[model samples]
Target: MKLHVCLSALLAVMASGQGVQAATPDAYRDLNHNGRRDVYEDAGQSIDARVDDLVRQMTLEEKVGAMMHGSLPAGDELGHGGAIYDLDQVGVMIGERHLNSFITRLVVAPRRLAEQNNEVQRLAEQTRLGIPVTISTDPRNHFQAVLGASTAGGGFSLWPETLGLAATGDADLVRRFGEVAHREYRAVGIQMALSPQADLASEPRWPRVTATFGSDPADVSRMVQAYVEGFQGGTDGVRPDGVATVVKHWVGYGAEPEGFDGHNIYGRVARLDNASFAEHVAAFDGAFAAGVAGVMPTYPILEGVSLDGAPLEPVAAGFNRQLLTDLLRDQKGFKGLVLSDWAITNNCDAACRAPTADHPQTAKDIGMPWGVEGLTQPERFAKGVTAGIDQFGGVNDGAMLLQAVRDGQVPAARLDEAVRRIMTLKFQLGLFDNPYVDPDVAERVVGDPQSRAQADLAQRRAQVVLEDGGRPLTAEGVKTVWLYNVDPEEARRRGWAVASDPAQADLALVRVNAPFERLHPHHFFGARQNEGRLDFRDGDADYEAVKQARAARRSVVAVNLDRPAILTNIRDKTDVLIATFGASDAAVLDVATGQARGEGRLPFELPSSMAAVEAQDPARPDDSAAPLYPRGYGRGAPRN
Candidate 1:
């Protein structure tokens, strides 16, 4: 036993050093100074050649490690979410795994940013292949903290949500927005963004609708293409330092029955049939045409198909062979990487379990099952890989996966295939050659003035015009009244009159809660009474408060502080409703002052009531009764 343990340790050490000595000095040269390798430079036959050479030098264990993407725990000790950002974690994971590619959940920070870049560089040096790690992030150009914020929470630049961008109908502005995000990402060592959510807002109550471009399929497609072009710079090829866009939720995740959180739940089944699938598939088709670098599968299943037509019920798309191999790769011709959503492998069983404090029962009513415990993490991972998930996002079971392979649950060849796909993406990203960023260039590009100006312009264009008594609220006629839900400091900074009571105001402006429903005793009161009453109404108090104010002959405007869908419930109560989608105190104030016109429209339909939302078809387009106000229905001028 002692001899075997010693031999294993020796083998591990040798494996770690195997690819390091093979790296050529030319790999360090960024000939174009673009923070990436120049394919034309004589580093090797091509970036592909270098990638193949390095991949060949790696051991099977290293290859398997490469497929696992890991994130650090967000404890209070690290400040708010953590000092160890997702990019930093990705860097560490790459070094530990000897993998060139990974994903991150990082929110960009301008200060102490150099340290973040240095950590990634250090990790790249540790790997034998010297492959730079590609860190991915959520949409960060906004001020909302849905996914949580960093240590200096308020420092990040706030941009208008995608809902607003869609209303502009300007592909150029959307493209420029992507470019700005690309610049910010490059500064912080993020190479991929799991964004440009192309899913058409088919359901009005879907919580994530604000993340998308409004309800129009064509508009969604155009905006996605523009975003992809802006992030990658050119459709023909990726820019040297440009961030790769991951057009996501591959299928109609947004159309899940009743506009729920998860793709599948016990009550919420697939409402989309063949025709519905075709309409929603158009946006993904457009993303593929744009040559997007990555695609993420939704956790929901299509009703009919299976891995091998085994009659699998609620087929997990992340691990479903028919969907990933047959549809995505073959039919759609997506040559880029396909990543699973965060812990999607465990979603099937997890969805079955009761909702947690973080997730809440409201998500369950929408088909997001809170908790179920059937499949283990290893089982999910193996299944996902067989189905063609190239990389694991928010993976927690790397060691378990290694154990599963040793136990013969996962085949070595399958693991190799996953590793190859990841490595190929790294090579395609040109990380094998130029993996370092110039601190000077990063500093200059970090939150560039031009990008901020573009964000401000985009924010202004995204504003939707609201009217009172048939008169549009123009800048001259607008008398702003700001209502604070949490604190008035941010709202008061804009010099608007902060109202303590809505009765005294011309416009009853209330900052509604971000649509997060907590399943406390009060929330579960109706759930205990009847299963039908399980759904929790989000922002109920705020909605009723605003409604009361509107009934008192005041022009009311309610701004959604989170995902814009929550605005649907209060649409009828107000003369003008603005789905600001995300919180940007400055941008919100600008819109209120008429300095920035309201250009945003509903990405999702505004459901008439909670019961109506629960009864609506998840897969079908929102063909419900005309919302008290339609998607494009907003006041063209300020109301008196």
Candidate 2:
């Protein structure tokens, strides 16, 4: 139980430069002589020995480091291509700090693919345990990158966004999509995927709903199961080739008022009543039943109860004992690893300073007791560990966590449990057995043509069919027009007429990106107040396009590429309000042509106005606000 004892053993063996051979019980064994530890084989004795050996070799600090999950910001300097932690920093963490797991924001773009691949390999080499750093990412196979966001990453295969995949309601398709995703991820050395946001799209306006499967619990459940099964393949409770799926925001995260992200609530009350909670729980429950490898908690408070009934007031589910231990572990029987959302440890004041552009300042302003002002770095880290968060994600304060453990604020025994869970997952992933990707096979496997085909199929399947004036919209007869907020190049490639002047087109398609300011408001206080209001009347670029179309005597077809609820503002001006959810040019075109039916219903109710959203109760049981369209409201029309 003393974490340092295990680390001393590991350091003694590894420091001697003697590679472990002939795996014993609890250790990974190459049963097939393939040099990869195949967990599927009956190598239990070896597996147990490896597990024991690993535990014995880990130091308290190393064990704690194993439990700490961090982020790799994909900035140009970091070598991946975005902004956050870079590759060199990642190398330092693994080489010096001995950290392993990381959740990455490096969307699989073509430019940085080589660099990222090299970095993963390098990180593996740096670790004395031969533990390959597991790379995790958000959903990327579709067109739903942040609207107006830079399309810098290499466009990988385009699958149906979560909603589109859900519309198919075909578990097999979902599974196949997951399988394809696994192939792509493994090709790129990605070990884990923070995907298939199992949160039901219960509220339409929620900014992240586009990433969800759908509104109905049943549909969401099936899709969740299929996603897990596909991502973590094998009927034998182990996926040999796929990345592990992390089911997220356990219980009622999707039910936030108007489906907003990260809003707090008092007591263990859910925005939806018990009935709705049951439905939501069913979806997450199904994912657990399907045997996902990880679970993540949202930043919201459930009812008045912090996860563990901790007296600290509104403890984040990430550090809530009741939520993680009582519900997720005990009741739901989730035995996998538990990960904290990014910077949950920074909830304390030392690391929780006023938000910069990188961090949301509004989190501090929200008067939530758990804000950076009240929580210290050590406090946040201790709270998270005690609350049963096995891994720290997007960790900006790894040094603080290390220091806290050294000071004994966090128990060494607890740290080992976390490390054990993490190593177990790595073992389950067969990482020890197959730490290296075949460089020759990398190109073939990374972006396979078949996977691309699957993506294309998903894109087509995900298309939403919209009708204007009782007639299905078709490209043949209609003067296909592209309006508001699309990359001009994308519009042109799709064969749609990109109109600078709204008056010239018969149908005006307006695309709206979710205002990032809305998600992270403090950074743009004055600018946000003036422009961040979700009102369609606000002079948003997309809003202006719709108004222009209305003035031109043209029938407007509005396609909201972000959240579906943005359609409420221009519902009156639009001849057809098509919520493609996310931007997939192919899917958008297909939806326009009626080749794909709009099966996606509003996941959350669209508030009538900004006031309705502001005044809405976060703890309210009902979300019956007047939506442009209700949940499950879809029009079926014959394909043109």
Candidate 3:
């Protein structure tokens, strides 16, 4: 073990090019320009001692800055396009604000990302304390590219969404995926992952179902545990080379009352009864058992819920002490850092609270203060700190937190406590020794052939064949194919000629997504979110295409089930129905042509009709009356 640690340290030093000799175990960085080594800078000292020493030495301004995890702004005003980092903006955050943690929003290649992250760390090295920046990011190794939920796969190995992983019902596969994602993320210099969302997919119409592990608490628990274990290197806490995983949205975030997300004002509260809410809490047991490094509080205010027979404080989870302190920290014993969801403390202005068609909301207008919208910014910060949040995500205003501390709104001890946790993680991650990563290694390691092969296999296995119609799907009989929403080149690669018209083909290959409606276009995230109506209706483009293909020939349909769709209307229209969650064209083709067998089950039940969807409770799972398909139903059989 000792030799392994030494070798790892040596590799990190060599990769970083920091010139620190691995033979000298007591080596330290002279961050303060002092002749003597500070306790925090000495690599030989214990982590607790280093954290305490660092906390004691930090100024109030620096401590406040440490609690704010802001975004690494883009180079130009159009922040969404380029991967280039705005060094000037980063300098202001690091040099003036004293921040050492940031979430990178740049969507670039692995080498460019690593180089930019190294530049950020270089700026941090010049600081008075030289605390290394711990960079974090949302889930970027999947197909979903929602603005805040997930990012595009880009150069990373693409896998099916978490729901698809749940469909496979293989905890080992989920763990393997985490291991791959960890390697890819660390290759790009990301130290923290804001993912492995433990929230259950209880609500059929919820927009974020693709990111969850499904509605069954037991399945979610198993998947979550495996996910954390894989990402953090083991079942034990974060290892030195491991990327820290923040299992998120603490409790009951999936029970959206009317299929509206908590990001907008229309979905401020998640309606949950006591019994149903317990199931939501139980879903996170896997993450807690794995000793996840961090937890992100949910944005929605959990309504009709309580703890120990007392009603929960009517506030968002970030500001609710009963949930964060009394339950999460006390009863559950989760000793990790608690990061508040983005903009929880930001004010809800006119554009935020209510945007018109003429004045549509954007990123700047996002805020989810919920029950405490009346409080001042400093007061909100104090409330969040008191509620047990160690860091505020998507926030750069350290001044507000500093004011809260100076004015005694937030106690100084709490500030130090938060700092200790943050610093301890940085030390545990070996960031102080060497925060840089080799860009060349990043380019080679990320999206390697082996990882891609594993991910592609997973994508194929995760396809849930809901309706096989007693006919095995095989490529032996198929000659000419008509493709809808499938690439013609993929058909040609499979030794099948592509036919322009479905009537002239031997088989019709059609793919569609589970139905959704954009109900709130005026709100920022709401506009992009897949909200409302999980049923296929007439005139719908995807449904029309499916009907057209079925009318011509035996149509084998593949629907991307981002949400549990009401498939009663289209179930009889096709010969075979397969459900996918972020699968590739090749993967779907492989399953459709019997190149690979879909060894997956339904993560969430398919409601028979929209009536059943509306009549069922949003807080419960698989309770719709006369469901089209029950949870765990698949073509071949269910796996453990």
Candidate 4:
């Protein structure tokens, strides 16, 4: 299992005079099992020296394997939802292919998750180079569970969605949230976070708005910077204890035409004009300023964007050199790894390109080649590498990339450069020193009492009170409350009597989600995504519940604003209207009962009508001609 670099290779690296220092006696892991301490194994060496040493020892196959960030397959590949990794598959990926990084999709308890990651690291320790695996994950500290967008909080402390964080308008709170999330993630052996999305929520209809800070570029920038600082443990680059963050959907991914997402073939183009596009790019300034370790290119192809008065290439951000190289790296001075969005290099076959009712699209059928569909797999690899992408996400086909390098499609120097960046991060993260986490400590740290208390308080403070026309919810006169879409136990716990029927209660409370359409039921992500309409019409079940509550008594209605819904109709039905990003039934009830502060402002405008929403520009913020409530509007008290 030991694979040591020859003495000649070490001597050659030393002769090159790249980060070479006098070899000193130091405690080391002997990762290469070379019978003596090597430069990379020495903890005393600089991260740059260690990266250079490691990269020099890596073969072409190993280097290519380093560039592919694949998923940790479950025991049953067909049903891998929140399942533990299959050790057999893990061995094939790590031992045979030399892959040392993976995205863990397991949604088990904190202790079990930590134990599983430790097991994977043990297998990696037995490998040739003994490079520990760096496990990464999507946002898993929130309530939303849109398959590819975010995961549900299982044992982690549950916070409001990113939009809810924006609603609080507190950068410090957002930073605290990141700190808590980082502690929980690292407790379970996750070294990287694929989150803190800096994309502006400009397009209200976009399904991923819930994951963003808000629609304002400046606000998003401020929050994004705090998020990075909190997660990375400082205002500088990632520290040894910090989790490396990957701020995502670089540039303008929120400007999808008609609110369609790029995760599906039909929604691959992000319509961005030159002026509006600049605003979208400005949103990521905070992440850049915070020295984030990684950036993920958006999946959509920029439609109307240009560079220096010339039309740019009509391709996705991952395959666009103008965007990645010129704008991000050269102009913005981003010296970090550029990870492509998932499956950008895979071929879009008939099933992926067009799924029918008979063959509904599944996760396996996803492949987002976009404008580069005509390119071969090897050609796609070459194009992405030249475009400045350091790693291909959601794919483990390093053989294809290796072939491209051998065929002269990708330069060996460029491949080496990418390998250096990847290795540098791993060294900086202290993954080489120790990648295993304590399972017992993980159970004690993840979702501890103190963290949950803070999270619950955050949930209460993040609720936006749009209107309070009826008697104040704090009034002691109200006793018997009728609940719809709320747990009766929560009301009972508040010492309030819960009425079985709406008519028998003194007041009624209702909860509903902003209306959405299953527009693309046949597509994988499209089916899971909450797309299309943001209006709440009469016939809808949620709207009916509101109507029934209003008819019974003064109703206090709270709606989950995952998308900026047109509340002109619902506004008239209920006496009180409140907006929430993501909160538990108890948290909402606490806010409603004046037990906690609920002064959060609207992060985005609620359009007055569907006409205003459709007529508005997707890339512009708060541009609705007539909005029911403008951004930053919220009432802290009951209205007269």
Per residue, candidate 3 scores C-alpha lDDT tens digits across 377-431 of: 9999999999999999988769888888889998788888888889989988888
TM-score of each: 0.78, 0.78, 0.96, 0.95
Worst 10 residues of 4 by lDDT: 11-20
In angstroms, how far off is 220's CA in candidate 2?
A: 2.2
Question: In order, what lDDT does every prediction score?
Answer: 0.58, 0.59, 0.86, 0.84
What's the lDDT for residue 374 in model 3? 89
Per-residue accuracy of model 4 over 425-446 as CA lDDT, tens digit each = 8887777766667676788888
Return the top candidate by TM-score: 3
**How should the candidates be ordered by lDDT, best one leading?**
3, 4, 2, 1
Q: Give lDDT: candidate 2, residue 451.
A: 79
TM-score-better candidate, 1 vs 4: 4
- Report lDDT (Cα) of residue 313, candidate 2: 38
Q: How many residue pairs of model 1 clash at the backbone?
A: 21
In candidate 4, position 275 carries an lDDT of: 92
Weakest 10 consecutive residues of candidate 1 by summed lDDT = 12-21
After superposing candidate 4 on the true structure, give the runs of residues whose Cα lies further than 4 Å from its correct spot.
Answer: 1-26, 75-79, 637-640
lDDT of 2 by residue, 1-640 (tens): 1112233233212210011122234444232334444334324535556666678766766776677676564563222456334667777777677778776656544324534654565555545555567777776676655421112245456675777676555678888888777766665566687766777665444555667777677778778888888788753344556678888877667676644455322212235555566667777766877888989887666553333334333555776777788888898888888987655554333213345555644433332224333667777778778888888876533677787887788887788778778877776766664444433344555556887777766655554444365765666555446466555666567565666676776556666554434444433231132123445656667667767776433454545544544455576776665655544655665665665655544444555666555565443322445644555555652223
